[model samples]
Target: MSIRDGGGTGEVAGRPRLAGPPTRLRAPPAASRPGVGRAAMPNAPPREFCTFYVAPPLLSPYFSVGGRACWEIKMRIARRAQRLAGTLAILVSVASATAAAGDADPDVYLLIGQSNMAGRAPIPDDAQGPLDRCVLLNDRDAWEPAANPLNRYSTIRKDLKMQKLGPGWGFAQALLAAAPKARIGLVVNARGGSRIEEWKKGTRFYNEAVRRAQAAMKAGTLRGVLWHQGESNATDPDYLDKLKQLVLDLRADLGKPDLPFVAGQVAKDSPVNAHLARLPQTVPGTACVSAEGLKTIDGTHFDTAGQLELGRRYAESINKLRRAE
Candidate 1:
């Protein structure tokens, strides 16, 4: 018996005949068919048991000489299959990583300013929820499901109990409604009764805001900034001037000169809203949401309903600004 190579194939003593154990291995049951799923054939061997023959005879043929060439060919095929499986595994891993990143990191928005912007309204027991596709940057600077008392994570906020629903809740809900597929991230760092001067460039409030926003940017992106401070600075005749500078400084500091800034009016009918209304005129990318008809909890802070409504208004304005671009 001798063997020879014909092209990349092998030729043995004669045409190769089926040779293996005499044990019968039946075909997979009809249940193994595409839609049926399971291979219920009791006589079927494990999938790894392959003899390349329907019913190989009980012939323990010599595996040397004539069969050596054939054996070598089978080895080459098995090696190639192993390499291909390795490549496929790598591709699956990469795809899973990409999906994980998208799920965890979404579009980020910076929430800055006074108590109202920080959500000073009372949230009822049956208040909404941790919005879908929306996450919040908590006090530890970690992303988590968005919920009421959104400003509770503010490193520079008032007492935790004082933290309640702010515009962030309604704003996220409204934004998601407009862009259902998008995920949102909010970094809230507002201080209660804080004046605009406190958020100016180089100020403690301003510095903390920029830090939190930058950290959030690592997870997602800075889409816009929401401002809702002014009650504490109601009597300042130069409030608008300070505000314009704040916007300018923020745009520069955040490296988003054209960032959309949506400012909400306070609960009180302070002259601050008047200045806020004129913000867009002096600033390039600025919008003011009116607090008219909006009710407050204590003549100073918006009630839960009012807070949610105000958030919707802010989201509407922000969306319009984004669309304009």
Candidate 2:
């Protein structure tokens, strides 16, 4: 039989012709019914025929026109999923890195000067312990829990066996207490009987202090400098000039020109008390704390109570400076 063209005669030559428009063969609808696609059904019963019917497009090699479209759709979906997963992974990594950086940034304070800054009094029972949020940069260039006798390398002391209490411990404690969430790091480089001349730029003590301060800065931000000296330079005529120069040199070395330098006055009876009291006026970004009422152990270094008070005073001055900034 011959096929008839639309609007053509019913018969072609002597053969009979098929009637009407020819019916086109189409692949069956894709298996979109639940539990009937390529995916397996969950919790199917034993002996159950969970048929995952392949569409007619996949039945023959030469009839794979629809199958190509299906494969391409799947590929697009897979690429989209991979891109989404990669984006999520990158976001998580960035968030983790930011948190780690914040955790490592603490408030760092540099403590330097002479015996008073080194703490020459006996450690009080209440102050003879380590602070949780305070870390001391020791002479060995290591970070350890901050406690009493912070300036361990003071030349006046033979060993830590006879270590005396210094204001550093109390200063850290007070600062931490005032700012509960703050992580405080103390870089103590004070030495007993250290004169202002010894702390001049290019000197061993000044170089060491700068080195330690720079090292401590790696673990946190440099906040301020706590200075309590003048006992040895009391009689020097150029004491104030040398001290002012020291502050400038320190700021230059640390790369923090406006860094706060809080100096504490010597005992009331000390001959250098008058000079120390004028520190704030003589130096920029500097303040002086009073030791007028504080008692001394042997008419020189502060006693336990005095050290604690001095630390609190230093913390107060530091806080004030920070607020002004």
Candidate 3:
């Protein structure tokens, strides 16, 4: 995608760049405040994983033809191989065309959030699955898995290895299932341990994310953003206003004020109370999904299955919004 004249050089706010994890609300002493989400109420343990899978490379075969003939047999075998290769190529091209021509054009969704958006998931040994319309934009603008869950920068405090199981994958799967004609492109830009304020426009991470998403949009690849953040805002009293402004700023910058954006509330009993947590979703043109039954044991994230469910919830939210529009 072509970059605007001063696009990549602008700073977010007056800050030189985003530095460190943004400030979250300070944890209050046990006696003073109510906790976040349901985990705070009773016997709820943090959600845990049942399995995991790492993706593998896709392979294509190469063939050489040999024959027992002095001349004609060898020529025939070579011709046959050439015809077979041509047929295979045509089949592949047809498949790709069919996939693209289904119903609605698939969207490239940007998943930006905190640790929950990045962590791990359990992909099966046979899970090298289809990616006809899914893609992720790295810092370099190359496409990888649009929904990789593991935040390379975030630490999973637990002894168990965290797998890549972010909600974006589920969202993609759900969208495909519901609308086979739609393609889903995902770009992740969430930083673990980072707060909302840290994501302000000028920071490197913020600018980088904006650059990536904007590039995708300019290339006509992105459809919208799937935002699930705000645990960091638990401590910021002015968070609601700031978040509202952030949404306005993003739409203005992206040139899609009516962009189909969908977001989710954090699970109950989080560091921030549930009531206050719902404010950002209230912003115009933004939709929010309830996190009541979701959330992991640590109370800060969603478990593997929870992430899938969250993705489904997000798809439903998006579909409903689209229908409303």
**lDDT by residue (tens digit), candidate 3, 22-100:** 3433333343222122111122233411110101122011000110101000001122454446435544643443333
Q: What is the C-alpha RMSD of each candidate to the true structure, in Å?
A: 19.2, 26.3, 21.7
Which residues of candidate 2, in runs, are more than 4 Å off?
1-102, 153-158
Worst 10 residues of 3 by lDDT: 67-76
Give the clashing residue pairs of candidate 2, or none. Answer: 119-166
Of 1 and 3, the candidate ahead on TM-score is: 1
List TM-scores for all candidates, in order: 0.69, 0.67, 0.61
Global lDDT scores for all candidate models = 0.70, 0.66, 0.53
Candidate 2: C-alpha RMSD after superposition: 26.3
Model number with the top TM-score: 1
